[model samples]
Structures are given as C-alpha cells and as structure tokens.
Target: MEIIVAKSAGFCFGVDNAVKKVYQLLDTNNERIFTFGPVIHNDQVVNYLKRKGVKIVNDIDEVNEKGHIVIRAHGVTPVIYKKIKDKGLILEDATCPYVKKIHNLVEQKSSEGYRIIIVGDKNHPEVIGINGWCNDNAYIVNSADDVEKLKKSDEKICVVAQTTITKEKWHEVNEALKEKFENILKFDTICSATTKRQSEVEEISKVVDLMIIMGDKKSSNTQKLCDISRKHCPLTFKVETSLDLPQIDVEKIKKIGISAGASTPDWVIEEVIRKMSELNNQEVTKNEVNQEDFNFADALEESFVRIRPGEIIKGKVIGFNANEVYVDLGYKADGIIPLEEYTDIPDFQIEKEVKVGDEIEVFVQQINDGEGNVRLSKKQVDINKAWEDVEKAYNDKTPLKAVVVEVVNGGVVASYRGVRIFVPGSQLSDRYVKDLKDFLKRTIEVRLIDFNQKRRKLVGSARVILEERKEKASKEIWETIEVGKTYNGVVKSLTDFGAFVDIGGVDGLIHVSELSWSRVNHPSEVLKVGDTVEVHVLEFDKDKKKISLGYRKEEDNPWVKVGQMYKEGVIVTVKVLRMTPFGAFVEVIEGVDGLVHISQISNKRITKVEDVLEVGMKVDAKIIEMDLENKKINLSIKEVKPIDPPDNNAKETGENKEEPEITEHKEEMEVTLADVIKTSEEVKS
Candidate 1:
C-alpha cells in the first residue's frame, strides 16, 4: 500500500496569534497577568504559556491589577470590559483579531435594528463575547436546527458565525435563516485557519486505510477535522495518546496517515509514529532524529493548495477582458478569473483599470474547471483584503462612509469597501429618513453590526444622534402642562369616552362630559377637526402618566350671585332652549336657564304646551317660585285665561270652577326668556 500525508495540517493564523500573545507577556511583565480565558483551546500552548507566567481567570471578581489583566485570544464580553473599567484596573486586550471582529458585529447590529443570531456554541468564549456586545438581545444556536431560539421581527435579520466553525456548517445555518426572513444579513466569520485544516483532513482520509488524528477533546476546530475526515474514511480515531487506539485489525492495516491538531505538538505526533513503527518492525526511533526538527518540505513539494467552494482569497487586479481577467498568482499557472467574479466591484471599466503583465493577485477558487482552466475569484479576494481594512476601521471607532445602492425592506442598501451593508429604517438617519429616495446615491456615515465575512452580511446604525434630540424635545414640552389652568389645546384623537390631546411629549384626556357646558349628544358636535379651544387640567398623575383634561372652562357657575336676579312671582321673557316631557327648558341669560313645568304652562283648561309656544319661541312667563340652593326656576306661560269656556269640553269642565278664575289664572303666569335667564343667575348665587 502507498503512504499518503496531507499538507496545510497544523496551527492557523488565529491560533498562532493567540499563542504568541500569551508567551510574549511572560518575558517582560513579571507581575501576575491573567488570561480572561485559557488563551486558546490548545492545551499544549496553554500549558507552555502558563509556565511563562500567563494565568487563567474566569470571572471579573477574580481579576485585579497585580500587574496587568489580559483579555484572551477567544475574546471577552463587553460586560467584562465595563466591569474591568469600573474597577479601575489595567486591561490588555490579547483577543485574536478575528474574535474582535465578531464583537464589533454584535455591538453595531444589535444597536441599530437587527435580531442577532450567533451560530456557535453559547458556552464558547468567542460567542459569549459577541452576545455581550449587543444592545438588542442576541441568542446562540449550535446546530442546524435549534428551536428554543429564533429571530422575532417583521424586519430583516442578521446572522454571524464563530471564527473556528467550519464553512459548511455556517452555510447550513445561513440557509436556515433565509427560510424565515425575506432578507437575511449573513456574515461568514469562519477563519481561514479552520477551513484549511478541515480540507487537509478530508484529502488525507480518502488516501489512507487507517488514520490517527491527535487533538485535545475541547478543541472545536480539532473536533470538526475529525467530523469532516470521518465522512470519507470511517476508520479514523481521535486521541491525545497512543493508549486510545481500540482493538483494531492491526494485522490488516498497512498504510496509516497521522496528523495533529493545533493544540497537539509535533513531539506527540512523533510518539504515535514511533509506536506504529515498532508494530511494523520498522526502526523509526526517537534517538536517531529529533521529531521537533522534522522537515515538511516533502509534503509541501507534493501538495498544491486548493480552494473549495465558499473559501475566501485575497488578490489584486492584473489583467482584464470584456468577459474575464487573468491574474498572476505564485500558483503553478496564472489564474483565469471570470468577469462574474467581480460582482461587487463598482463601475467596472476593466481595461481602463487593469493592463496585461500587471502583477495581480486572486483567490485560488478551483484547481481546474472542466475546460482545463483554473477557476479564480477577485470578489472573494477583495473581501479578505476588506476585512483587514475593516478591522482597522473598527479599532478607530470611525463611522463608515457609504452610499445607498438599493432600497430594501425596513432599510436601504449601502456600499462600502465593495461590500453592501444593510441600513435599517431606524438607522438610515438621526431620525427616520422620510424620503428614502433622497438617500439614493447620497453619502452618509454609519456604524456597522452583525458583520460576518464568511456569510457576507452586515447591519449598521445612524440613529444615536436622533434619540438624543428626542429626549431634549420631550423635556421642553413637559414644563407647559399645569393642573387647573386653562390653555389652548388641539384635539388629537376621538373616542366614545374622551378625546386625547397632544399637549407635548405626553397626552391628556378630555372626557365626553367635560367637552361641553350642556349635555352633549356627542363630543363631535362641539369639536371638529383642528379645533383650537381653551382647556383646564382637572387632574394629573405623573406617576401613572395620565391626565384628566377639561374643556368648556369659560362657562362659569350660573348661580354666582343668585339673590339679585329673581324673586318669587316675577314676570320675565325667556326662549325655550330645549323641551322635556315634564317642562320646557328656557334660557333667559347668557349662562343661565330654567325649567317651566307643564302645569305652569297654563292655569285654565289647557291640555298641551304647543298651543302657547314651541321651542326657540319667545314668551312671557311668571316666576311663580324660586329655589336658590337647588338652582331651579319655576315659571308659567298661561297667566291670562278666557273668563268662560268657548267649546263643549271647556263648557263641561267650567261648571266645577268658580270664576275669580280666568283673569287670575292667565295673569298668574306669562314670563319672558330673558327674565328667566337672569333669575337663574340670581338663584344660583
């Protein structure tokens, strides 16, 4: 059997970065410095860093400035940053650059208007850092389907990934979010280190009959490597030592491939090899050659790095055509990239920008297309370059300058750095941008969120300026409302019970009964659209945010000075303001009215009130009685009567009466509306 070994097999850029940060602190700072986490998932690197003076701390309370406190490469939550800041302790951020990107994505996306979904283990330090940065709540989903948490919004959603997660898993989760939201902002934050290792494992499994993968159990990227490799060859086993090898058919196994994770040192891979060589009677001893100095030049010579679908590459423009371009890579052949690859490159006049023989760079997308042409990409190349610039932009805390490219639901699409970032309706301006059309092609500043380079999704905010102004507006209006003082208020809304008026930032209610001085059939009768009227604050409960507002305050009490207006048995002119079954309502003054009882309409054989007068008709009536305390007025319309009956019904009724009658009866009543109104004023006093 032929032996095959894979290339691109060990520590990635982030892991290397994390490991170096921890060990470097040991050389200068003797003061006890603590890693906010274990530094990186690699136990070997962590153990080495610990010997060099780096220590692990799990909580804020556990941290103090003995010398310095370092945030680990996995990153820490913003909550952690605030706690450290509050303690007045020194903080040294050792978080990997990729992890910091996730933090900024959560912070900006959550602040504007996006439901943040982190597709990673919630227990992981990187994901925890991401969730902590968000102002709006963010949830973590570890697998393809996690129902306990889902996005809740009518607006679009944003999705991000952990830097260590595999590209394939990220894609699966991204597609799932697309099922729910009409538009999804997905950021593929999966680091290049993770995909490279997974691809190496996949190739190794197909060639080898038996595989030994060495890694720590807690290493996420290591676990993914085993998972990817297992699909092609089921005979693979993950172990930290030679002791984990099960009862395999050792006699039948000939060709074996051995690889180690980032956390597994080269010495460990040698130990496993030494044990395997012993079984096959091959003398590969630790004494002859040091495994630490093992050469990988042979592996490199045989291997040609391949970029799978969804992998990102950074390159530059070299040459161009109407349909395609040629890029000079250090690869075996110059890469041929299609024009479609530059979908996001703006205003492309390819030949004007690029010329032949220009040293251009690009992503090695595919080893070969069916036509013997190696497929390459410029867009993916730009994203990788953009990430480097974006990281700088975040560190400076500067606003992203961009232009609106398209109008999407609940937001506008703005292009920055050859990538489109979503600007929510609430983030399009300091206040809502009423005319989004006006924003088209207009340049503005934005703070981004939910950014994941792997998924290519981002959300941004511009409304922090708006909310500050809103608070100022609210404060100015609150000072004007006063209880028991009438002022002009405009009606805002109508209901069966009341009308709500916008006095300022708050609202006040005018009960239907308080709408008019008289009994109103409906409040609409006295108030119309845009009516300006005086009102009084009857009650105010600031704690409850409620107010009892009153209208018609201009009409004062009618009984202010009752004794001077009317006396018993006075005659007056009045107009019938309204009619009731028991009496006719008559107004004799501007603010006063009285009732003329039916019995007081006439003293003769009169059966009906319409015979003398109808509503709105003026008449003379006598004030037969008065009640100042109760505000009642008694008047009569028929004080003068004929001395005898004119018809048979009256002729029959008159035989029972003695005739002091007609003159006394008609003269006893008859008063005018004006007299009754004045009398009501007198009685009310």
Candidate 2:
C-alpha cells in the first residue's frame, strides 16, 4: 500500500505555543506548576504532564496552594483572570492571539449596543470564554436550525465564530442569521490553522482508499476532519495514537491517507506513520511519501506556482460574501480579500462592483493568512496607483474628487481611492464653516495643496478649487454685466447697511433701501444669509470691483398702487403719526402720510392739533385733494361724521352696546410731500 501523509497534520501555532510554555515552566521553576485545564485535547500529553508534577485544576478554587498557573490554549473568561489575581497566582497566559482578538471585538461591539451571536458549540470552552466578554449574553448557535429558532429582531447583531469550527458551518449559520436580521455584522473568526488541516484532509481523502484521522475523540476539530474524510472515503478510521490503529485490508486498499488534528503532537503522527509503513512492508521517512503509484495530478498540485508577499498577481473572481471575496489565484490555495481591504468608500457595495468570472489584479498581503487562504488586497493596489496620480495632480494644479469620511479636530478627513487626505477647516470653503459635521459623507472637489510622500501625508483644499471657479466667473460677469438685468443670487451675508449676494461668483451689495419698496430698519428684515433672490444690477464700478444690486421689483413699489387705490373725496381712516405745530401728520397707508391741519382737527374750534388729536390716535377722514405728481394727500377729519359719546347712565349700569365698525380703506404709498412740509416747519421753530 502507498501512503500519503497530510502536510498540515500536527500541532498548530497556538497549540504549540501553549504546550511549549507549559514544558518551559516545568523545567525552569522549582515551584509547583498548575494548568487551568488540560493543556490540550490530547489525553497522552495531559497524562505525561501530570506525571511530571503538573496539576490540572478545573476551577481556581481547586488550587489549594500558590503556584504558577498556565492558561490553556482554549483560554478562560475575564472572571477566571480575576480569580487568579484574587488567589495570588502567577499567570502565564497561553490564550491564542486570534481568540484574544475575538474577546476584544465582542466586548467592544456589545458596548456599542450590538447583540452578540456566537456560531459554534455552546459547550466548547472557547465559546464560553467568548461569551464571557459580552457579559455572557451571547446567543450560541451551533447550526442553521439553532439560528432559525431565534426570533427576528431589528436590533443590530454581531456574529462571530469559534476558532476551531469549519468555515462551512460558519457560513451556513451566517446565512441563516441574514434571513432574520437586517443589520448583521459577521466576523469569520475561525482559526486559519484548523482550516488548512481540514482542507488537506478533504483533498487527501478523495484519492485515498483508506483514511486514518488521528486526534483525541473529544477534539472538535479532529471530529470534523473525520467527518469530512468519511464523506469522501468510506473506509475511514479515527484513532488517538498508533495503539488505536484499526485493522485494514491490505489487498483492497492501494492508497492510504493519514491526517491529524491541530492539537495532536508530532510524535504521535510519526508513530502512526511508522505503523502504516510497517503494514506496507516498506521503510519510510517523515518527509518521503511513497512515489511508486503517485499520480500526475498530485505532482502538478505540489508544483503549482509559488507566491510571495508584496507581489502583484492576477486572479479570477470565484465567489463572494458580505465580508470577503474569494479569487482563484491559479495557485494551490485561493486568495481572499476582506471587505476592509477592498475599498475605503463608506458606501462601497461589493456585489454591485464584483462578479464571478471577472479577472482582476490584487496585491499579495500574505501567502498563507492562517486559514490556508492567500490574503490579498485590492485597496493597496488602488492606493498605490492613486498616490501617483495625486502627486501628478498636485504638480499640475489639477483638482480631484474626494468623499468626506470623518470630522477631526482641525479639519475633515476625505478619502480618495482609499488614501486619506486632510482638508483643513479653513480650506473647506471661501466662507466660514460653522459646523464641520455638515461635510461628513459629502463628496467635494479638492486640490492637493500639500504632499509628503515619505510620511504618507496629504493635505487638500476645496477652497482653492472654489476660488479658481469664482475668479473665472467674476471675469465673465464683469465682461457681460448690464444695468437693470436681473440675475439669481444667493445671499452671502446680512448687515445693517446691506446684504452681500453672490451672483455667479461675483459678490454685489444690496442696500437696505433696495431690499424692499417699504421702509426697512435693517437688511435682515427682508433677506437672510443663504436666501436665493432675484436681484438686478443697479450700477457697478469696474476699477473699484464694486457692484450695487437692486432686490425690490418695480411691480412691488407701493406708489404704483396709489393711482388705482385712492381718489379725491374718498373716505378713509388714518393713524396720527406725530404732532407738528401746524397739524398732525396722519398715516393714510404704509409709507404714505397726509397732514390733518389744525383747522380740520374737528368741527369744534381747537387752538392746537394736539388738543383734539394725539399721536397714534385713529380717526375718520376724507381725501379732499390729491397731488399725484408730488405724491401728497390732503385730508380733512371734519368732513366725516363722528359718533356721539355713550350716555353716562348706561356707562354706570355697565350696559353693553354694539358700536358701528369703522371701515378703513388701505393702500400702498411712498414718502409724501407732507414729510417735507413738516420737516421745514420744525426747522423754522
């Protein structure tokens, strides 16, 4: 029989590190050594350690004396660490780095109001440790059915996987979760080492007649490997060591494959290989596989092109999920680009951008990214090309489009082709930016003002682009501007004197008097900053770079309605505005005041206008004459009939009586000649 040994059949990096730490502690320290649990899943290793005076304690309370406590590769919860400190035990942490990352992720996500979902065996020690980080409130789902049983909710859900679980299981559980939750965050936390070992076993089992899966029965990853092997080859046997090797028919089995779990020791694999070689009646070395019946496919698989880190390669898109895309790199292992490595655009949609059978170029980040998949980065390639273009644009004085991603202390951070460009607050616009957050998620054109290639620093200015456009527009406006020609403009600012409006990049002043036909106390009464208004150019001084704009339309002038609104012998109600020595200036309408001479104050004789009429008093009057040319009106209060006073008896008895309503005819008017006469009389006095 020919033997094919899986290359990835031994202790993985994390398991090796943990076991080595235990042995090193055993030899260097004279004090008693204790492990939080069995150092690994293998029974032989644990028994051997026990023989060497290493005590295995399931709980912290079980340790009666002080000693060096080594945490196992399967890690412990935060409470366990606290207990170790309380008991004054020296901790030699051996938790896997990848597992520690999961702890941190769950803790942070849970604090951010995400419901944590762990896709793995609930009883597993690793899952338990991860659950502890999220306050032990995580939903542990082992299969799609478990996920289906969960009620659908709008709460954001963050999904993570046990390091040893299969990728298929992780994906399956995630797919089920997507059906129930709209906002689900998935982190494929499966250990890369476990993936490689499982993948190797699946490939070997396909060609082998008999397969031997070696690892402890309690090992979850080992059991998964056995299941994969059994599905491919019916004559699959699981064994803990050489002693457990099952009886095999040598005549029927031409090729036999051997694989081991991540926690299995190298010595155990070698011993098993030795037993298999003896059965084949041949001497075999660890590195040499029987080549008598080796096929061309196996040779070609081993001779596939070698890949190196930092090298650019072309690949065909084979598959994709929300978090990552898989590409066939024409090598033994396919490449995977995580979502973060694809693009920096916040709204980047992978499905919309990528498709199967599409060929693309990628930068190799790692030849083997723990999970036996080549780690690739499309963003790095884009950023590399983008920086070259950015530098060229900076030297050529060209503008580039960028999306704002964050608002920082001094400026906003914008992303252009995955590269971050800092646009300072002063550079955001020509006008002051009151709130920087308004620019977040907005795309704007920017010019590169500063570039530091060595330090990877890039500073951009949107204001520069704006200024250039405005300069061009100002030139055009100056060449084509015409008096009385209307143009749409945006109000830039408001002041007591006037409003500055931007009409096609040229700022023109709109005096407060020109804002409306009626009198205005301030420009803000008619126009505010950012209001769009139709303004006509009243006049301009080319040398002074000043343009006066008119906002009030002629149709809106109050005097335009005077000829149609009022005529001679018209009855009206007027409000007394102020008292002059000769008469009281009474307002007929807004911006139109008529004088009521002291002689016309009432039918009864009065010495002064103030004797019968006080300021702000309303009275009935008739327009006896109108000077439309000079915009004046002569009013006489004596021409209109007045109502008699109420009886004193009725007033004392509190009798309610309905008074006739005075109808006041209102009309728009401009400054009347009455104001000129009143000013001259006041000056003489």
Candidate 3:
C-alpha cells in the first residue's frame, strides 16, 4: 500500500515545549517534580513521565511535599497561581502563550463592561481556565444551538474561542452570535497548528482508501481530527499507538493516509509508520504484487527530506522572548527569527503580536547562524509580498488603508503594510491641509496615483478617494431630491446672506429670512458651522447644482395660532415698537404687530400718536379690527376703560368711600373728504 503521511502531523509547538520542560526539570533538580495535570494528553507520553518519578496532581493543595510545580500547557486560573505561591513551591509556567493571550483578552474586555463568551466545550480544561479569567462569568457555547438559548441583551459582547477547537465550530457560533447581538467583537483564537492539522486530514481523507488518526482518545484536537476524517473517508480508524492498531485488509487497501494530533509524540507516529510498512510488505510478497505495488511498499520507509538554505517555507511559532521568536519548520534544527528580522516596525511588541502555535511564512536566511540554528526572516517575506500587493492596487485602481507615520518637508509619509508611500500636501485632502501633523498616526484611505517599482517609489492620494465618494453621493442626492421634502443636514459654513448646509454631498443655502420666524440679521444668529438642523427643500435647480433650504418650521410660525389667540374687542398689553408717520406700531406678540392710529391714541384729541405712546412704552389696548389674511391688527387705546383709584384720606378715617365707575365711549369728530382719505391711507399703510 502507498502510505502518504500528512505534513502537519505529530506534536505541535506548544505540546512539545511543555513536554520538554518536564524532562528538563527531572534531569536538573533533585526536588520532587509535580505537574498540575497530565503534561500532555497522549497516554504513552504521560505514562513515560510517571515512570520517571513525575507526580500528577489535579490541584495545588494535592501536593504534599515542597517541590517544583509545572503548570501544564492548558493554563490554570489566577487562583492556581496564588495557591502555588502561597505554598512556597517553585512554579514553572508551562502555559501555552496563545492560551495566555486569551486570558488577558478576556480579563481586559470583561473589566471594560463587555460580556465575555467562549466558543468551545465548557467541560474542557482550557475553556474552564479561560472562564476563570473572566471571574467564571463567561457563557460557553459549542454550537449554534447553544447561542440561541442565550438571552438577547444590549451589553457589548466579546467572543473568544478555545485554542484547540475546530475552525468550523468557531465560525458557526460566531455567525449565530452576530444574528442575536448588535454589538459584538469576535476573536478567532483557534490555534493555527490545530487548523493546519484538521485541514490536512480533510484533504488526505478524500482520496485515501484508509485513514489512520493517531493520538490519545482523551485529546480534544485528536477527536476533532477523527470526526473530520470520517466524513470523507468511512474507513477511518483512530489509534493511540502501534499496539492499538486495528486489523486492516492490506490487500484491499491500495492507499492509506496518516495524520496525528498536536499532543501525539513523534516517536509514536514513527512506530506506527514502521508497523504499517511491515504489514504492507508481508501482503505484497504473499500476493506476488506487481512492480508498482513493490514501489508503493518501499515508499513507506522514506523519511522527511531536509530543507535547503534560502528556501521559503511555512513554520509554526514555538516560543518567543524579547530578543527572538523560535519556529518549528518540520526539521531537526528549530528556526530563529531575530527581532530585526521579524518586522520593520519599530514599536512592534513581540509578546503581544507573536503567539505559540501560530503558523508564519518565513524566508530561510541561513542553514546555520554558527549556533546550529536555522536563521529565518519573516519581514523579508512580508516585504516581497507587499510590493506585489501595492502594484496590484495601483493597476486595479483600488483604495488601501494606511496610517500616516511621518510628516516630511513637502508631504506626509504613510505606511501600508510596512511599505512607505508619499502623499503630497496637495493630495492629502481636497481642501488645503494647513498642518500635515494632524494626519500623524491617523488612519486614512488612499488610492495609488503614481508608482515606480524599480525605483522603490510610490505616491498615493487621499483626495482622490474623497472626490470619488463625493461625486457618487452627489449623483444619488440629485436623483432623489424633491421640493418641500425635509432633511437633516449639518451647517457647513456661514455668510451674511445665508448658511450653507451639507444635506449629503450637496450644499444648500438657508437664507437669513428663512432661518426663523423672527427676523435674523445674520446666518450666524440662527446657525453656526457644524450645527445640525432640520431643513426643507424650498426650491432647487438641478442644472445649476443649487438648492434653497428653509429652516423655519411651519409649526413654529407665530401666525399659526393668531386666530385662536386673538379677536376683535379683546384687551391686550402691547409694547410700542416704533412710530410711523401715519400710526404707531406696537408688538402684540413676537413676530406680530398692531397699528394704533393718532385718532385712537386717547380719549382726547392728539396730534401725534408718539406724544401719548412713545417707543418702548407698555400700554393696554383693545383690538378693534383684525385681518387674518393680511396679518394685521388695529388697536385703540382710547376705547379701553381706565380704572379709578380710591383716596388714601378716606382709608385713614376708616370711612366707606364710593368708587367711580369707568365707561368706554368714542369721541365724535367733524368729518371731511380729505380727512376720510387720509384715514383710509393710514389704515392701508
């Protein structure tokens, strides 16, 4: 049988590091070694450590002797760390870095008033540990159905996944949460190594006659691999070691595929491969297999080939410190990426960005850095790909997001995926940018307007993107604009005559006369730049690209309630506004005025109305004639009766005094043709 082994099989970076830590503790120290739990899920590896005098305890209190305690890769909660410290035990933290990142994320988000949701099996140790970080308040869900049971809430939600869960499970739960919650943050925290292993099994199982999954049954990642394989290949068998291999019909199986979980050790995989090869060889000789079958039998014995220098390959991040990050390239020597080689960005924090079990593409710099390590450069790979992406964006006329990193002499420099592009001051915005420093560290969208790959020069214009969006918005506004329709707009600028408001992309003017029912001398009296106001489309000319907007509301018009508020013969206190040649104008209410003629100024004849009613005087007047259509009211002060006051001497004597009764009467005057014509002209005025 032809045996095809999956490339991403066997122990991942985290599991390997954890197991190695246990051995190192055993070899160097005489103190009793205790693990918080089984260091790994593989039974063979755990048993081997137990035989070597390593003790396993579920809790810190279970440790009877003072010794070194190693926290397993599946990290424990803060309570465990406190217990270890209180017991005075030497703590060796073997928690996977990627899992630790989730702990920090949950703790921060929970403190910030976000409800934490973990997408994984709640019973799993990793999920339980993560819950502890959030004060054991996280909602653990494994599928879409579990999300349905949660109560809908407006609280901001933060969703994180267990490091070993399948990508499909994470995606399914996230999609369900999106439908239920309006504000949610989803972090796909599934380990890259787990994803790679699951994907490889799916691909291999499709064409193979028999698929063999190797790992402990208790391992979550292992069970997931078996589940994925069974869907494509029914002849899938899961085994822990070579001794547990199931009986297979070697003659019938022409091709067999092999894949292992992250917890499975390399020795176990090699042993299984050796046993399968022996079985295939025996069947071939007995059946007198053809030359092609013999060649397939020999293929099982071949080992992994060595990688050459300067080759680009995928590696899993195993561990990292301040100086460098270590990667496993499926080779003997681990790859080392120095800080400078990892990224060009100066403020890059390795601990926050690089995590264990993450897959990264690296360019091999050297086979040996004189320290028996493979030197790798991740920045080199990124730089090479960034140029290609930049060229594509330039050719396709696609916009890219970039952050302004520096302000130079004539322009600003923006960094796009570590590639610097110069944006001239003129291209920074459609309007003049007085200070380029304002764009510093701010993210802006830009399209490449010019570039030269050979010269390593590029130019981008944020103005181009702004203009394009403005043009599209202008078109949409003109298509749907209707006269007298109201819109919410923001005041863009102010002038003496009007205020210009941006309803969408188009700017419409609100004349000072239309700003309010009350007179407005300047647009600034009613609106300032950036003030939001509701305006109606009074008139518009599409060809001129001009619009006239009205800001005064019909409901706010003072004349709307005049008919209900006033009528003829009603008494009112009026304020004299100004004196006209024919009459004195008084304000009845805001924006409404009444005219009092000289003839009706008082009971006695008056030559001038201003003589009795000067400007700014408050006087009681009776409304005689009202014309609602013309918005005019005629008031007569002489028609209103005055109240007489009692003498103070009568009160001092305690004598009852009679009060004088007041009566309203009109004064008759001689009439003339010129007088009648002049009165008529005064009423009209």
Backbone Cα, N, C clashes tallied per candidate: 39, 2, 0
Stretches > 4 Å off in candidate 1? 1-4, 44-53, 87-90, 147-152, 242-250, 281-685
Q: Best lDDT goes to which candidate?
A: 2
Tens-digit lDDT track for model 1 on 1-685? 2334445455555655665555566666667777676666644444445445565666767755565677866787767889888877678887778878888877788777888888888877778778888852776777667723465446757788888788887877777666666767888888776676677778778877887777765677778878887898888888765545445455677667666676565555665666776675654312222234324324322443445555554433434558888553433333578876754444567767655435455666676564334588766766677777666665665578777778888888987756678888878765345777778877777776556767767777666534455567556645655678665667866887878875544568899988866677777877774576677789887677788888865435455444477777777788988877676888855556878877777555545555555778887777777786887777776763312223443343555454456656656555455678889999999
Off by over 4 Å in 3: 1-384, 468-481, 486-490, 502-505, 530-534, 542-545, 561-576, 581-589, 596-601, 606-629, 634-685
TM-score, predicted candidate 2 vs. hidden true structure: 0.45
Candidate 3 per-residue lDDT, tens place, 98-136, comes to 999999999999999999999999988899899999999
RMSD of 3: 21.6
Residue 437, model 1: Cα distance from true site in angstroms? 73
Q: How far out, in Å, is residue 179 in model 1?
A: 1.9
Ranking by lDDT: 2, 3, 1
Question: TM-score of predicted model 1?
Answer: 0.40
Worst 10 residues of 2 by lDDT: 659-668
